[model samples]
Target: MKRALPLLIFMAISGAVFSQENPIGIFEDNKDIGNPKLAGSASYDETSQTYTIKGAGYNIWGQRDEHRYLYSKVKGDFVATANFEFEGNKEIHRKIGWMARASENDNSVMVGGFLHGDGLMAGQWRERKGADMQNPEDDVWAQKRYQQIIQLERRGNTFIVRAAHPGEPLQEISSKQLEFMPEAVLLGVVIGSHDENVIETARVWNARIDQPVAEDYNPGKDGWIGCRMETMNVFDGKRRVIHEKDGRFEAPNWMPDGKELLFNEDGSLYTIPINGGKTEKLNTGSADDLNNDHCISFDGKMLGISHNDGEGSNVFYLPLDGGEPKSVTQQAPSYLHGWAPNNKEVVYVAQRGENKVYDIYRKPIKGGKEVKLTDNKKWDHADGCEYSPDGKYIYYNGSKNGGTMQIWRMKPDGTEKEQITFDQYNNWFPHISPDGKWIAFISFSPDIELNSHPSYKKVMLRLMPTSGGAPKVIAHLYGGQGTINVNSWSPDSKHIAFVSNSKKSVKVD
Candidate 1:
């Protein structure tokens, strides 16, 4: 969660209009401006200062006779505006401005303000019950000029739609209508042509929406609310340090008894009490070169770690009370990825050959031949493997489509594989909630390059339900390598324990 402190304060002073050029809460499409992913014959012409939308045919969603525009992921109170002129015949049945909150299936709660070719302006709210509630006629039909401005404002679940002629005050087109106000929505400007003729042009400029001023906007709070780099000290509510360090500390897996946190610090495994005290190094000795990936057995007696020992990294098991680690994999190059709910089998990434491509493999902790789970020609690069609380499925990250990684769940045998995340962001290190209803993982925005090496200064932790939905960012902190020490879930599932880093001085001795 990243905070917008200055913007919040600025929004307070100007009724949320912090800037004239780009208001705080509004997003606009000038056709000339913004990154456009336009569909159909809609194209922006900067030279003519217009956006030409040609209606060659009718689209099933009432778009063929209409020119459609789309903007996604809008939240909270906002205003949308557009300017346009019609050049073709008056056969166009509907010219309208629309605001919609679309669901995953594209079904939406649509607010439509339409102007007929005969010069009648009408507005209505489109619901599942069919387009019902229509507003009383104002001046929408009386004007001859094609130029217009349209605006939509939202508060809670209610939306207020308005429109006006050029140089005219915005008149209320519709009153507060109850609708499903999405946390994020899509805004669009549409023009309908009843005939095959083209709708001449729509030009949008100085269009913006601003968010209402919020009272709280601290940078630290912003880090928690937005994706901003900061530090979060993972402590037991009583201020007991589970895993503390100067750099990135991550993946704090709790012992079955919930007494200590199994975490990684500086690429090695360590344990700290729940009450916060000195960290005891888990002396893997030669297996000390470990990564952040580690977990404890269901019985809490054995600890499995992915570590490098002279030859290469592989899964190794040691006693929870600290002892010499015994290598579990016979293969030369394998890295531990996940532990089964039974704690008897461990899943890891196995490199094939000189090509360096990797896939997921599983083996028993009691020393058995490895079983290949995924075998894609391209690198599978499976990670964050964990069995569901009921031991029904194994959730992990897989790179099957090109090189982009996505969350995937498969049966323990590697069958029934399905992609979970569809967003453009990079989601990794999935930790399933103990109750099996949610998954928490690290999310890197499109701004963060995928191939870029992990650094402590940029990254965010996000949460999404295992049932499938948009991921919500939960923590904005500067640590990625070992952000979550292990599967340290609270008994109530209300909180999670993960390690993060800051520059503040501390005495490690």
Candidate 2:
């Protein structure tokens, strides 16, 4: 944080009116608000609307071990204004004013003025949580300061901090864009005291918030877009293009040796080297007409796919080396989603009734009667199902509770069910990590009002700790439909393989 002051025109306004009769809501220090155990004291005068503090051992939050102040019940966006004149012992680390949490003792998106022992005032605008402190290029909010009245304002996700000399116009210190949690935040102001050049008095006035007028708006435009690919490296964040062309290419699954990627482009199955090069067509013959969902077996000896053969879509398996396809399901309206970890079974979403509602079902890979896994009647459309690495759980995303799609997990027998993700965004396509410590998924905002479907535009790929916590966005780009984990973990778990479309559209071959 840096310290620089905004210039102020010396209007002949009386201090009484500025402190007491001000329009914005104000709170003055009354009684001894400073540390009681210490020798310091703080009091407020309602007539002057000024809060003053004097003595040693005085702090904002009453903590004696460190110089921290805590103010609670701070709701909405507001400002804190204070004036301090101090004669402190020589120490460059002394701070004048700052807003922070009472418990953790950390600075937030607020105004902070620091007075170095060398007599220089520095100011800064900080976003500790959102900052990429390790990479300076990615740390857009990090800044430094010198003498200044600092005004910090937060408008929605954007935070602006400015400073100016006692009489000059405020100079912009720094402006940082941030996504703050929608909860009440704590705020405070404090001065760190060192050695004893001590007799000093401070006056704080004009501290209040100016909340913006409410308006109906879409906040999703500011969200990150996820890169959609069938075989994406989750750890390294690399997208491999197996069968990209002038048209749509999708659902890539890795070969057993991880040397090549198999996918569907223009309704035909094709194979391409994992390292990127020309693709070789896998002869689908009369079964060439395929949908966007496909998979490879654990042994890499077979390919299972869903395709429309003149009549309707059906699940089929073919030899990886290329051969006649074997129909695995006669069930009507079945679309392949994923294969079991053992390669002995496959999960598909089957449509039921005239409403076209879908429910998850599984059947033997070698052909057997389908077993219903989820019997919900609320249009339970399930997609991207995969077995946990340990084989204890099956993770998938489904549309339930109206249009809100969320990631869910169930036991192998579809017994114990649980819903993940409570945020307002539409989360889908969950893929658990091989280590089982994390789950990567795609999220699209359903709050956007548009005539078109919600999944068509920008989306985000996020990762969450398997134990449960807020998901962090890892990649932002355009994509949807066929994103999934199609292969085992790279020996290191540092990369994932998934399919994605090229930025430029290509004609279908």
Candidate 3:
């Protein structure tokens, strides 16, 4: 059933803007390639951060290609991802997916992940200008089309594409390396109609372009990238950028009052309205060398923090509004993670004894002997030890024998230990929702070290039922250590606030 593309007229779409220049979400330009018989158009919904591209082309196959591209020029290593679906399509050759090209010439050296109307997903590439397009002989034919997210990553001369359905982990589909490929390329969303006079439309959402730091790149030495303060609806998977800045900031803690969010930047704490506005720094007295490890008490009356006191990081507590922090741990390197539901005690990770292995420990707020919660092995590590809202269990991320990190839970008395998630990814920071019904956590690829949660990497924020079920990917972006170290769920449990990183200097009003 070869179907022709139809040009649908859309006017005054709610919250959407039809533009080719200025701000189009993350893209910088939108243009049509090859000048098809009929024109093409693109739109972006700022509220949903989604893109809709409509194009008419005479097949993007063979020697030359024609399509609509909404793109941004990216250099070096980068990862582009989006969830896309065509509208009113029947042509099996209609194409839509992520693409990278050396130039906008009608026939240019390019590589892209393409999803055809007939459920054929393949990595297509052109070796040189005016060359015939080529794809791997063995292509993935999804049983359910447009139900997965497409990710295209570039590592030097190599390009790779990976896809995953909802509630599942991403699996690599295809990859290729071209020696002639340039360092900079037009990385973006692409759509094409199989016929010249017809137009095809697609809606793409959750679109992200992440420029990761090098393996040896150090923020303090190489300079920091930009930051985006974003909130996402857990159920709908819709993200809204509430704030942006040109520096480093991490770990957003949703204020219990649900009006503002607290985060750490430049070793200090700052608060911003949930809807986006100016940031106000919190007065933490002299305890300024703070890290991302921080949490708000269940009662919302006090704030627990991990501050470096010239020796090492230690746990401290102060009034939620503003005040001098009081020391909670006598030992150095005690990082705060969670506050007891009773608001009388707090849990943190520390290295004691000669082995110096990190493990979970609990202590009273007023001051008392710290009780060791988990007796990890010499090589084992534990972090993000947070208590559920009902106080029934303490959820955290633990790694043993230098393996991948997995989510685990224990009783407040450090009993009834159980491992919740078992996968290849290094899952971290099990933050239970305020209602205690879901556990939201951040995940890193298996390639990363099991013991560390480094910043500036491709990561996912996942959600799963507290009782037990397959975790679903709630947000995919470039972030890591400072992304969601603390519980950032809105008080109503409908939204989550987190930070994402990018090398581009973007400021959303």
Candidate 2 has what TM-score?
0.52
lDDT of each: 0.54, 0.51, 0.82
Instruction: Indicate the worst ten consecutive residues by lDDT in candidate 2.
Output: 1-10
- Put down candidate 1 lDDT per residue, 437-508, tens digits, no spaces: 878777655554442224333345667788888876554434444555346665446566765433221111
User: In candidate 2, residue 137 scores what lDDT?
Assistant: 29
User: For this target, which candidate reaches the highest TM-score against the unseen true structure?
Assistant: 3
What C-alpha lDDT, on a 0 to 100 scale, does residue 283 get in candidate 1? 76
Model 1: what TM-score? 0.51
Q: What is the lDDT of candidate 1?
A: 0.54
RMSD to native for every prediction? 19.1, 19.5, 7.7
Off by over 4 Å in 3: 1-23, 134-144, 506-509
Clash counts for all predictions? 26, 51, 0
Say which prediction, candidate 1 or candidate 2, comes out ahead on TM-score. Answer: 2
Q: Candidate 3 residues 136-223, lDDT tens each?
A: 4323344445545788988889899887776666667777787777776777899998988788999998787776667777666667
In terms of lDDT, which candidate is stronger, 2 or 3?
Answer: 3
